[model samples]
Target: MNPKSCLNCGHKISDEFCAHCGQKTDTARITLQSLIKSDILGSIWHIEARFFRTLKHVLFGPGRMAMNYISGKRTRYYNLFSLLLILFGFNVLTLHFYLNLNPDEISEGNSNILEFFSKYSKTILFVIIPMLGTNAYFIFKRIKLNIAEHFIIGTVSLLGILIIFLFNDMVSLVGLWKPAAKIFGILDKASFVLFILFPAVTYWNAFKKSYSKPGLLWRVSVLYVLMGIESLAIITVLYRVF
Candidate 1:
């Protein structure tokens, strides 16, 4: 029976919900249909719907994504690591399959396909996260971020920089004219700064629990230098190994 008085506002109501307060007069018991509709299907729908919102938060809000995730507002955005992995996987596959043809064999196609695969497959891209994040953890050690957290920051930073790299890859694969390629080649190389600067900007926004402007700049700059050194070291090592 519908309660004569609403449980929430004590307003007289003959229906399931209180007219004024909108609280239900009866305690709604869970059913399989409701569970499937509201919990299971709704979760997938929400995540799918919020994909661009998550990207916008990462792109426009800087520290907002990390703050929301760390503060247990997971449903407000997508999983940070999950998004990172998807982008990384796509990047890896695109590089390997689509854009990694031998420049020397542009005329003959991949006649030496095995040789190309060997060199490309041995790429040390995995060192990216550890290199950036390790220095971040140490630089921000006063705030006591864990390795995983630094990894998240590094991942987000790389995601930002990867946009440029992906664009560069697309331009390279599209077979631009010689002069155009020369111009973009310079841009492609110059974009390496964004690799470091993106994280510095992100951490500046996020790691502000106890830092003034100058202090934060100093710390993030230190992280940038350290990460840059690590990137150079990794590239040197890869050159030697491959």
Candidate 2:
């Protein structure tokens, strides 16, 4: 294969690395090895690193990660949507394994919580409405980030619930079921707050960008509280129907 010229400056290069700007030379070498090492493997490692960085920001700095993402420092971290998808997949995989190991244990626990989740899948998605709606309002009034961007962030918050629940289950091996359940309940509550916090913080940052105060924060927060109630209500309806 002929070496490609630099698209930036049209400088010639013999190998993968462009000597002038040090960019990886784009070429037709999309082979299995090249694709694996270059595309698949490289992206995986990058996403893994981003995922951990996101985790640190979320756990230690609360609201900071979402703010940074809105500030356009996004390439350094996973997009909120990608983070949600990865966490959701992980949650599903681990939850299946954990439940399979001791099916009765999950069923034996607080029947109320289990009943709540099992009942309301669609109503949970309703949270997306107020979430995205407020996002639209803010996007227009503040930083002008699109409404779709807010929806993506809201999706991430929902996925956080799955992640926290799985983390609760996995971390339980070292201790008894009772302690583990208590920890999980607390984490679950926190995850609910996180769902609301993500959008609220993002909107807050958008307002900050436009030299506005966060006066609407509390009203928006009430929308989230209603959304949370809607989530539980949907769960109850589902439990009865299904």
Candidate 3:
């Protein structure tokens, strides 16, 4: 039998994959069934599988997951920034649709901290992630992670926090019904507390194996102090601009 030329790179081959470019041997004409099965569903399944796997680690052991990525055990995980962007996009949709949130609706008189946060949560998160990365770099200097690696840890921690935030938003959607309105209000109030607590918990889980309880507490305290300073700086800038 003659060797079949690879449709992708025109290399002659008998194997299942192209040696030159690694395209599959069966590069037949595109059909509806093939497109749906191989292109659409295949891509979705791949992304979904990796996304869930990454979410599991991000939720339960973000620090360790970051460490694993830093140490190069990364194939099992989805791209962190991509996942962050997806969550951020979803948050935007939920804010608009589920919460019926509008920045203009927040009157100047009611532009308190929480209102400010709701108005600018996405911007705040974008600025704060890098600041938190910087804090981690300095605070956990003994861990020997570089600025980028520290940033990865910070991103992973924030991803977990965002997941919690997303869940809260989802449950708050249930609160929209008349019977659950009270519960919704309570959840809305509790979100601020969770926002503060989740990051601290994520960092602790990430670094618990690395630091003693007392040692970790003081470090986390310093981290939060840095975060507060950063938050104040952001708020000041926003207030001046707006």
Which one wins on lDDT?
A: 3
Candidate 3 residue-wise lDDT, 1-242, digit = tens: 89999887788989889888989898889899999998999989999999999999987777778888999998899999999999987876776666364454345676575566777787888776788889988888888888888788878877877887787777667776779889887887787687787668767877888899999999999999989998988888986776
As a whole number from 0 to 100, the lDDT of residue 98 in candidate 2 is: 63
RMSD (Å) of each candidate, 1 decimal? 8.0, 6.3, 3.4
- Which predicted model would earn the best TM-score? 3
Overall lDDT per candidate, in order of appearance:
0.68, 0.59, 0.82
Model 1 clashes, total count: 0
lDDT of 2 by residue, 90-147 (tens): 7656656665666576654665665554445335544664555554545345545566
Better of 1 and 3 by lDDT: 3
Give the Cα error of residue 37 in candidate 3, in Å. 3.4
2 or 3, which is superior by lDDT?
3
2 versus 3: better TM-score goes to: 3
In candidate 1, how many Å is residue 120 off?
Answer: 6.4
Worst 10 residues of 3 by lDDT: 98-107
